[model samples]
Target: MSYRLPARPRARFSYTRWQQRFAPYLFVSPFFILFLVFALFPLLFSLYLAFHLWSPLDGLGNWKFVGFENFALALGAQDLFWQTLKNTVWIGLLAGVPQHLVALPLAFVIHQSLRRYQSTLSTILFLPYITNAVAIAIVFATLYSERLGLLNYARGAFGLDPVRWLGDPGMVPYSVAAVVFWRYLGWNVVLYLSGLQAISEDVYEAATVDGAGRWQQFWYITLPLLRPMMFYAFTLTIVGNMQLFEEPFMLLNDGGGSGGAGLTTAMHIFNTAFRDLDLGYASAMSWLLFLAIFALSMVNNLLFSRGGER
Candidate 1:
């Protein structure tokens, strides 16, 4: 009778414990759910559509399996995909190269000279980046007008003939590139400014004590230290420029202005998918563009890595 005395205590549920166990997950669940519904679903569907010939007119189940035919057509010599790709690359180089060249030095100057006004200047520089894309494009379209535009007006004031900034085939790419450059230049400057700020003042002081001149310190110290940020900014520019659409679309219209000179791969893909109603081919071309962007990004990464190692 004495041996059977003690009874075990059962576990009790606590609201606090339950909340602690699942609160973080519950908070994050909305993002994952939305991502699955919106992002992942669309991405997977686009990939599936890439292999099938279907139009919205044909509806969902009427799709016919075409395998890699779409990809083949995009890569073929007769297709406009290659030309659009060339245009895209040319415009990207025009805009992207100068962005870094200007931003790095500009940021360096601001960082060194205008520390007191840094916040105000950063805000001003960032205004364009934050501005609406459509609005920017529209304004730029007005400025790029052949005769009535401010730019041509300036040229005319200088006793120059009003050049067709957006009309000439040779000038269309440069025109589009200029807009892209103006819009993104400030963003790169802000990025470089941030990078410059992260650098230690002690390093500069040490260099100064060791008799290193400003230019020498900048060339040897600042640039090397800023490599990571440069790599980041370059990757963004490459990716953004590769997918460029709205500026060209708005400024040049869907046909990409005279001779299709401003037709970027993105605009081409849009026309293929929407205007031409060849969704399958467009999807395939999209994947191809993705591959191109990825390849360029990898090359940029490799260059940066090599520079770092050296």
Candidate 2:
């Protein structure tokens, strides 16, 4: 005769099918609730503000309706808006493109030739990205000063004249771009290194067996495989470089230096909101800037996307 086990009694809050289906959601509910309260409400309110004229001094009820005046003012009335947009894009491209260019090769070199010192080298390169932008910008500003600056001093040592790094409009972009490049190069390197690690070693071995040289293998196999990583990196760089404000703000004493050559669209927006105290107008400008960012990002996506499945 076989002895049968007794029935397992279910508790009031038993782990039933419904509970199992929603337990994960219940565990994560706090984040979604907070996000709705904080992020979603502010974004919707900002959209509302973009269409109305009002100040914090004026009560929320007193916000006067204004049809596209704010947009027109941002796009047409402000010379600095246009200039800042141009500067932002130029500086972003100069710094951003080279970041990947330098990082890819540097990462490849480290992965291939200097595997022993990879960690040490990566840390050193990545230091600048992790450092405070304000502090680093101040240091870079000191180095860039026209007289008695490290950069100018080095030039003089080589029998060159002291170039106005911050003063001259034409030179300003390059100076800012150089700092941006220096700050972000290592970040790109790290991204590429991680991507390289994700690539299977057997693929490289196969290429080698087929008598593919290093450059050929890299161009044909590695780059194609790294496209996804490249897309991610490119999107980050595009968004980041478009929103450049802090480094230039600190370096130029909060207004992008003389002539506003280094002034980014982000800085212009900040000035519009705080300096001019046109909250409503600034909100509109912000939306427009966001649209521009979306457009560019879409364009980037189009360029980076491959048609066929790999």
Candidate 3:
């Protein structure tokens, strides 16, 4: 008779081995857990709230389902939403257009000529962007003050009338836009500078060898290469400006100053949600604003992509 082969031993499961296998997931689980609790939950709840008429004072689970009435009201001619949206777009254009116009050239100048002092200059330019918005707004409010303000004092010294920077409805939008422009101009410059730095020096050198002038090289090469950064910066500007609230809110107060001239869509939404306690309508308006921002961003992307292809 042939000898029987030895039976193989079964491997038993070890708790330590299992722990080691899942250790990384265990370590990362807290972040996902927190996101689910805070961020994701609030977002889902807001969408739910958009369809129901519920006030915080009314207690939870007492909301009346209103279907699409909230959205319809916001979009209808009877609401201030359209006017506030118009104000937002106007101020956005006023602030955003000049930012790119100035930043691109300023960045080009800094990149080409100020290499030795780039870091120092960049830091100085970036100060406004990093400064507290509330503090900046407070200071600007003083500057925009009609009587005792520095701007008006200068006007007096020049034998000109003291302008109503914040009082006149016609001037409110411009005043608010000025603050937005000053705060974000430096940030755009920094973005453009980074874009300029990433460009290859050889391309410029080759252009120089080909007898292309500085203006020509910049127009043909730099601009084409900088398209991606321009798109990114433009997208940020669109989103930020559309949701503009801080400067106007701080300068003009919750009522939006005289004629509600400086009231942006964001400010309007805030007033609706908190002041009037119409959370549902405010939520609908917020989602609509989100859609508008998304559409503008898509248009920006499309333009840049087309430019890149050409």
Candidate 4:
């Protein structure tokens, strides 16, 4: 009786408390909801579809379960899949390796020698990264033309023959890779520049007091400190270049242009899904490509970790 009804249980939560606890989630719910519908659900559905055979014409729920048939066919001795895979890897290397090599040195020079012009230089460099891929690809397609292109014009000025930038099978990958390089190079430069900026000037000052010359300071101090950033940049380049699609697609067109030299794995999967209407096969190919990317990432991780430990 003295308990006096135990204070009526306080309604478990006051209105203000409920609002404070859940208001943030309420605000963020739209993103999660849209992600579930657009990304997660589709990803799950694609995984399901990877094991089944169905065309858009057959409608949903009419899929025939085919186990790993889709995967088998993709990984089989089919020249298209393997050839495209080779092209993807080759272009990835062509674009990615030079990107870091150039970006690192460029960022270092700008950071050390051109501090006054850093902002202007960064803005100029970053423009390509933000430019619309399709628009730039169209411009580059013209520049890459076998004749009457600016690049050919430049070559003519140098008394060299016009190079087939996108025409020849051997040249097509390089052409696509160059466009990829131009677009992503600035991104890596910005990343390296940020990492360079984060480094303490006091450390450099101390090195200077220790009689470290510019090259010595850069070699011993800057390079070691920049290892983390280098790893991060390398990883990004690996992931992006491995999955490259748009520039090659737009510049080379749907069939990946002459001899399918510019045909990436993404383009192949796209053709399988939309053109052939083989959603299952496309999903399987996508997963395989994903695995390839994952493996390479792991290899990169291993290399970085080993270097760090050493």
Candidate 5:
């Protein structure tokens, strides 16, 4: 009896079964944990900070509950908020309108006329989108030089006077917009190209048999079918243009250069938060800008949904 065999490790499958059930969760847990600590926490903190007055200088827990004061200050007539908004919209339209305008036709051309060279052309076009923003801005800055720049040289060749690209306030926005357009043009082209490729050739063949011309096919078939992709591309453009920074910042420097024509809402927020040490004000401005972006996105959604229904 005393020599009774120790109970065999019979069917102790709990640990193995549990691990099998939860291994995926264990693997994915780190992402959610990191996201909670880094993204969700900071977002909530920023929202809280938006309603209160505090700076890093004031230390943690010293924030004063100022309610809507920060919002009021930003939206007040005296603040630079309105001007920045206007600048942002202007540059956004300048860059965004033409981006789609040019990208659509360019993609159509490549898809229809340059089938054999699609890969090469796409790679060439996509280069700018992948290029470093700072590098692009710096190179563009030199090209925009009023005196000895290539642009001015070209103007001189045309017997026209040199235009101050970054220097003149009137031209600064356009200059910045041009760079933005160039950088994003290829991205949109690629998006449209992918959309075009996904379209069934049978549809186009049927249209062709029905005597549809190139323009008619594009207008009726291509554009209509490409709506989903267009919506996606347009949404990207809207969000990206609203957050315009880096290029303008690098090209014009932190001060936004000459009359602050190139100063976007993002730049203003950065200056307020970091340079001026007004964290709460900047947070409020950010939330306001976010609201504006949301409103615009909703409008776009309504437009697309209505078109889809029609």
Candidate 6:
């Protein structure tokens, strides 16, 4: 004989339908409230400010509506906008590419070969990421100093002359990029490590049984599967490096040292708004940089997606 369970009674205080229907919203109301107060309001305010000529020194009442004159000035004839953009891109590319190159193999080796010391190695790599950029830049500034720096001392020990890492315009980009690379190298390694963890060990064992070597397994199995993570890491590096300011700023000072070779778009924008008090023009340049970043990210997505399909 089969036994039947009794049905439970509904609570008398509960609403028939409406309360149940709005339950999810009740649970998430705090997030919506925060989004409105913090994110949405600031974005809208910035957009409004972008189209108006106003200064921090001037009151809100002083805002004057200027159509696209600011945009025209940023795009049409401002030579510094283009020059700083070129510098930003050059430093970004130089620093960004090697991050992934070094991170992938380093992560894989730690994941597979050095399993016993994995945690310790990851913590060491992650230390640089957690260190303050300004502080690190200050340290690098000392390292780049010509006569008394450790870098120069090491070169002199080898009978080679000290190269001017900071003073010369030609060497400034490399110096800045080097600092950028060092700061983010461990971050990319951590990202790659996460991706590596998601890959199954069983698959590697199966590949090994089929006479696949480490290199072959990496090429055919690991990389193809890690495409999504690789894309994410690459995109982050691009955006962060493109907007680079702090390291260069602290290392080279506001004037970009020597000949402004280390000057980035973000630093230039800051100078325009603060140093020159050109709020309207700076706002326009900011919007223009945002557009460039958005476009480049879109291109990155397309390229990665297409590559994954193949």
Candidate 5 structure, TM-score to reference: 0.94
lDDT for model 6:
0.88
CA displacement after TM-score superposition, residue 194 of candidate 2 (Å): 0.8
Pairing residues by index, what is the TM-score of model 1? 0.93
Better candidate number, 1 or 3, judged by lDDT? 1
Off by over 4 Å in 1: 1-13, 307-310
lDDT of each: 0.93, 0.88, 0.92, 0.90, 0.93, 0.88
lDDT of 4 by residue, 134-209 (tens): 8998899889887879999999999999988888888998899999999989999999999999999999999999
Estimate the Cα RMSD of every predicted model relative to the unseen true structure.
2.7, 5.8, 3.0, 2.7, 3.2, 7.3
Candidate 4 runs further than 4 Å off: 1-14, 307-310
Compared with the true structure, model 6 gives a TM-score of: 0.88
Candidate 2 local lDDT, 1-310, one digit each (tens): 9999998987666578768899889989999999999999988887888888988777678898898887888789545677888999999999998999989988988987898999999999999999998789879989998997999999999999999999998898899999999999999999999999899999999999999998998899889888899989999999999999877887776578778889998988898778877789888878988998999989888888668321
Worst 10 residues of 6 by lDDT: 301-310
Question: What ranking emerges by TM-score with the best candidate at the front?
Answer: 5, 1, 3, 4, 2, 6
Question: Candidate 3 residues 1-310, lDDT tens each?
Answer: 8999999999899989989999889999999999999999988888898899999999998999999999999999989999999999999999999989998998898898898888888888899999998899889989988988999999999999999999999999899999999899999999999999999999999999999998998899999999889989999999999999988998999888889999999999999999999898899999899999999988888888874552
Candidate 3, TM-score vs. the true structure?
A: 0.93
C-alpha lDDT of residue 174 in model 5 = 96
- Candidate 4, residue 240: how far the Cα is off, in Å: 0.7
Determine which window of 10 residues in candidate 4 has minimal summed lDDT.
Answer: 1-10
Give lDDT for model 3: 0.92
lDDT of 1 by residue, 156-272 (tens): 889999878889999999999998888889999999998998999999999999999879988999999999899999999999999999889989899999999999999999999
Better of 1 and 2 by lDDT: 1
Model 2 earns a TM-score of 0.89
lDDT of 2 at 298: 90
| Pairs with steric clashes in candidate 6 | none
